[model samples]
Target chain A: MSDSCCDGNARKAQAGDCCAPDGNVMLLSCSGGSNVGQLANQACVELTQEGFGKIFCLAGIGGKLSGFVRSAKDVPRMVVLDGCEVGCAKAIFKEAGTLLRGYVVLTDLGISKNKDFARKREDIDQVKAAAKQASQAQV
Target chain B: MQIKILGPGCPKCHKTEEVVREAVAEAGVQAEVTKVTNTMEIAAAGVFGTPAVIIDGDVKVVGKVPSKEQVKSWLGK
Candidate 1:
């Protein structure tokens, strides 16, 4: 039902076929329905522009398609960005059978989740900075 | 060039990566493909959905994994 051209084709690809990488951080972020979700989305854009990591999709893993999931699982590491404490992003990774090298929750950084909220740059920075530190620490 | 397979390792992530390589190979471009597999790292990269795509640090697709042709276009093929 989506407008994008690849919607149907993406679903058709197998789950286990991994697309080889030339050694860069291919990333997946959970744009949840919360403020942190929005923050995550924005941060991904910044990171992508900054050459920090490459963005990948998350729904495909949940869909259980063969190619995307398989290629993703074959990666050296997969990062999960969970907003608040729900761990929704992590849940997707778990279902895909991929080992997560790092995991982050916005609430852990003191960001309150509220229905009527406006995402702030500072809040996104806090998460982004924290995630960067965590990634460096993991390495 | 930087190759990105955006997803948190879902089926889409795997597909994205596969398509990325195919696109890169088909285009004959040398680039680095990164798998952002860390929750904290992913958050640092800034994503709210399970599957997303960023090319060379630029968020290209947010929610869904596009097809090989779409990916090719994202890669500027």
Candidate 2:
């Protein structure tokens, strides 16, 4: 629903329509039950909105949906964002049998994991920075 | 009939619920529509995305909120 005229007819479009041609790069994020997880999930949404990449559905992959698993396997590049050291995003990739690339962990960036921490703009910036760095490192 | 709208209470999820209710009323079916907010139960129901619909234990929609007409068709009206 980015455009006012977007009546959501493009819901079935390929993820690449929002990202690189053919959707070579995929973004997966952990929406864990913690504040950091929320931050990670929010960052992915913002990143996708900014056209950094298409945010693939992590829950779909976690649910082991065949289409989602197949799509992730087809992506040549992927960024997995985890809110904490628990690495739920990474684990989803592993469970789906897809190779992980451009991984970024919020806790690795010194963000503390807590159940009650407020999601700050600064935290999202930190995750975005780390994600950008990982994408660059992939080059 | 039992209908479960699954999500973490996001806007789109709410919209889906609204549409499901409308569809049920329009179809004139005696259906109980439930909103599932629990993440674990959502996943357990085979919904990997938010704003999904479950009809009688079968997943009928996922990730997107369908129109009233579409929902009614799914309800077999």
Candidate 3:
């Protein structure tokens, strides 16, 4: 009997050992009006699909929604991906009085911010890697 | 002093309440300790975390259970 919950899944059976979705990890990304922002958003979407974590509504926290704020605060693990140094996502957590953990800034990954809406695949991959690294470090 | 433990009745929240009560007794402080399990009340207090400890309306801890010593310090012991 495998002790890991993910081991029971056929997907994990094919893919080998992997982490199961515990529903404790939350992902928040900045969907700002910029390429970097979109990169962050795109990375979060992909990561969620891969079961890295579930993408949460940053706007809810920003709007001071009670349920969203409570969920964000109570989650055992959180990944915050910001498109740039502008730190809109980070600022939201700060303003909401919630502890910001596992933060990653796309600009810090050497991906320069631009007005281009067409996000590059390489940049998206880089952001995803950074986001994964940030989340793993917290774990 | 008013002390409130805010959580949605998780095990950690229960542990927090126990730690707080013990802290109050050991600190010998004249305080009223209350457990707040209501989600709206927890959020309305401007706290987003569970197992939160509020002392006299000021949020002291959130999201994690605190040790007895930590609770005692918050009680000014």
Candidate 4:
């Protein structure tokens, strides 16, 4: 089992592990070079596929694009996903000052990082279930 | 080079990833493809929509997935 990583363990909160309390949240995935990173990607895909929420962009947010930044700034909530514990996803929003609504870690799902970039079908499905669960709990 | 695909794994995101893979093959370039989904991570990457593409860490497409030719052009391959 993993640690609770609550506010008490701020630094312990990996990229996709910390979450905020607002609604209208957006999901951001690390999508790095690992099986779990792809899992995080799949989770957001499933959530968007279900129409539960729309997937937002990280580059636009990172580059500080006016429309992207303004829209995110306006949104009441946002979420970041890190495939692993590297926290690459969280660092992006952290720099933008946009409120992070939620955080999730793919490794927490038991998928480890890897050099292989091939995303598996089962992996995506499992991550989807996790994303739905996370979203339901958030609401 | 950096390759990014937007969308939360919806059909679009998946398709974009496919397109990216195909484009990479067509170009014969060993590019690193990344799929970003975290909201904060996405925000941090500076994207507001999903099913997007980033080439060399630079945003090339967003809001919708582009065609392989489009991706190729974006990559300037």
| Best model number under TM-score | 3
Residue-level lDDT of model 1, residues A33-102, one tens digit each, is 8778877777766766776665667776677554456546544544557777887778877887766666
lDDT of 4 by residue, A16-81 (tens): 323221323466687766777767777776666665565767767787775475456554445567
lDDT of 2 by residue, A112-133 (tens): 9898958999999989878877
Where in model 4 is the C-alpha error above 4 Å?
Answer: A1-25, B1-77
DockQ for each model: 0.04, 0.03, 0.07, 0.06
TM-score, chain B, each candidate? 0.80, 0.94, 0.94, 0.86
- Regions of candidate 1 where Cα sits further than 4 Å from its true position: A1-22, B1-77
Reference-based TM-score of each model: 0.53, 0.54, 0.61, 0.49
| Chain B TM, cand. 1 | 0.80
Question: Could you give candidate 3's per-residue lDDT for residues A49-128 as a string of tens digits?
Answer: 88777787899889876557766776678889888898999999999999999999888999999998888999889888
Chain A TM-scores of each predicted structure, in the order given, are 0.76, 0.79, 0.83, 0.69
lDDT of each: 0.62, 0.71, 0.76, 0.63
Name the top DockQ candidate: 3
Error of 4 at B8 (Å): 24
**Considering summed lDDT, which 10 consecutive residues are worst modelled in model 3 chain A?**
A1-10
DockQ of candidate 3 (2 decimals): 0.07
Relative to the true structure, candidate 4 reaches a TM of: 0.49
lDDT of 4 by residue, B1-77 (tens): 77766444455567779988998899888788877655555555554445456676556654455688987776678
Give model 1's TM-score versus the native structure. Answer: 0.53
Better of 3 and 4 by TM-score: 3
